[model samples]
Target: MKLTLTLVTIALSINAVFAQKTNPNYDPELATELKADDYGMKTYVFVILKTGTNESKDEELINSSFAGHMANIKRLVEENKLIVAGPMLKNEKNYRGIFILNVSTIKEAELLLQSDPAILEKFLEPELFLWYGSAALSEYLEASDKIWKTKY
Candidate 1:
């Protein structure tokens, strides 16, 4: 049994080495434009928008703030600073949404978040973290723009 396990491990190791070979479709120019590292990944700032301490009963203020938040999102996307932004489904952690910013530092992310009206009004609070993900992620926005039937 031990000999069989050793043989299996050796086989897996050989497969891993073969899998690490350079991609046949590698595009150096695209990688450079996306700021991808050797592994085709880049640093980003991940933000979790959580329910804030404010419990304002004023509906008009809340609605206006959210409208401004949406506008801010649009501006950030156009600026190429926000690569991903979406609301989370109902969850136990009180997380309202998320934003994956095309930035390397928490400070930069904080500066970007300052433009969000919901955050300013204390309707939503942000928690930022450094994230590493595929540099090609922003490419999806182009295709996404084509598929949307209506603007929200």
Candidate 2:
């Protein structure tokens, strides 16, 4: 009878433990304080592709609305939302600028990027893509983020 009770207790304890999720970085207190308890970290990857027409149109769009787009990016940075954005070198083929957004999901990132004024210039639709289960944001932001956190 004692052994049966011990086994039952152990089983109940195991079940309880399994029911709870454990992740060190998940700070409920911070999330609640910020009023973003429902949000979690996600990767937003923007891939720049080489297209004859899009390259030129994108350049014009960027030149035309550089002020507005930059202001928006700065705001996002102030809000602790903007991850990183920059263009790949000219030498690189098929890919150009990549912006990594630590946002809600792929869809959320897409929606956010769509707000980019330069993107609305009838170009290649911003020509971005979503990456799931990624090993890491491209090498640039990884290095930049490290430097960023160190500075601030």
Which runs of model 2 end up more than 4 angstroms from their true locations?
A: 1-62, 92-94, 123-152
| Tens-place lDDT digits, model 1, residues 59-149 | 9999999999999999999999999999999999999999999999999999999999999999999999999999999999999889989
- Please write out the lDDT profile of model 2 over residues 8-117, one tens digit for every residue: 99999999988866667877775554334344333455545332244564555567655566676767666555566665676745454566665646677676767665
Candidate 2 C-alpha error for residue 9, in Å: 26
lDDT of each: 0.96, 0.57
Top model number, TM-score? 1
CA error at residue 61 for candidate 1, angstroms: 1.2
Clashes of each: 0, 0
Quote the RMSD, in angstroms, for model 2.
6.9
